[model samples]
Target: MPKNRYRNKEVKFFVTGHEMEMIDKKAAIAELDRSKYLRKMALEGYIIKQDFSQVEQLVYEVNKIGNNINQVARRANEVEYVSLDDIKYLKKQLEGIYGQIEKFYDGG
Candidate 1:
């Protein structure tokens, strides 16, 4: 075992069955043991819950844009020409998607 460096003080508490269940659920989601999770919360006062649904949605939107771009490319290849307005519209759509991603990063 490694030597302990900090103080040896201890704290104890009790909670109802419902509370313990909630604790277990939270710890499971964080993929942390109960003791470590509780210690982190006690020290940090709160935990930022992980939620990736927004990221998934963003990826979905990007995939849709890619599909649209592919279709436009296929049409242009078949016809051997692409209009200036179509190109400009595609550029504007890409810029709007970029702005949406920026807003997500900025937490706006």
Candidate 2:
């Protein structure tokens, strides 16, 4: 045990062969060690696994938009002129992204 460890108590229990197999499978599914899995299940009765695919997609979209905005900025610098319609379109795109972020936070 590490000196900085806070868990000082030891727990012992017995399980049938079948029960042990089930526990191992469940622990593997949760991607946790048996000790942590058992402790969490015993204390919290359940575990929540969060999925971030939507967040990943959001980041991808934001990056693409950022790239587009940078291209527009580069063009404006080269020409010394920026179209108002282009600015409006970029603003609309940004607003749509913000709406998605709001929806994510609001659990919509």
Candidate 3:
């Protein structure tokens, strides 16, 4: 990055193809084009040009994992006699991991 890259205050980041696919998938899931979604996030500072040094990023990852587990549970519930108990157990395990993630930010 050049010293002047931040002069205009908007910088371009080059992501790998695999990372681009993830961004595309997220944009599709959010029902917006990538640029539009990114602009909205930047304006709201939800995905913006702030520093992460003060906060733990794993908390964000844990929240995302919790969301994924909920989605999986929803899908599991749609099936008949497919070990809901085991699914519940798995969700608990994810929650445990989530707890650890939170603990990382909790001064532990």
Best by lDDT: 2
| C-alpha lDDT of all candidate models, in order | 0.85, 0.91, 0.71
TM-score of candidate 1 against the unseen true structure: 0.54
Candidate 2 structure quality by residue, lDDT tens digits, 1-108: 567779877789999999999999999999999999999999989668988887997898799899989989998999988899989989998998999899889986
lDDT of candidate 1 over 1-108, digit per residue (tens) = 335947456778999999999999999999999988888889986668977777887888788889878988998999988888878878887898898789889886
Clashing pairs in 2: none
> What global local distance difference test value does model 2 have?
0.91
- Please provide TM-scores, in order, for all candidate models, with all chains considered together: 0.54, 0.59, 0.33
In angstroms, give how far residue 7 of model 3 lies from its true place: 17
The candidate with the higher TM-score, 1 or 3, is 1
RMSD of each: 9.5, 12.1, 14.4
Report the Cα lDDT for candidate 3. 0.71
Residue pairs with colliding backbones in model 3 are: none
Clashing pairs in 1: none
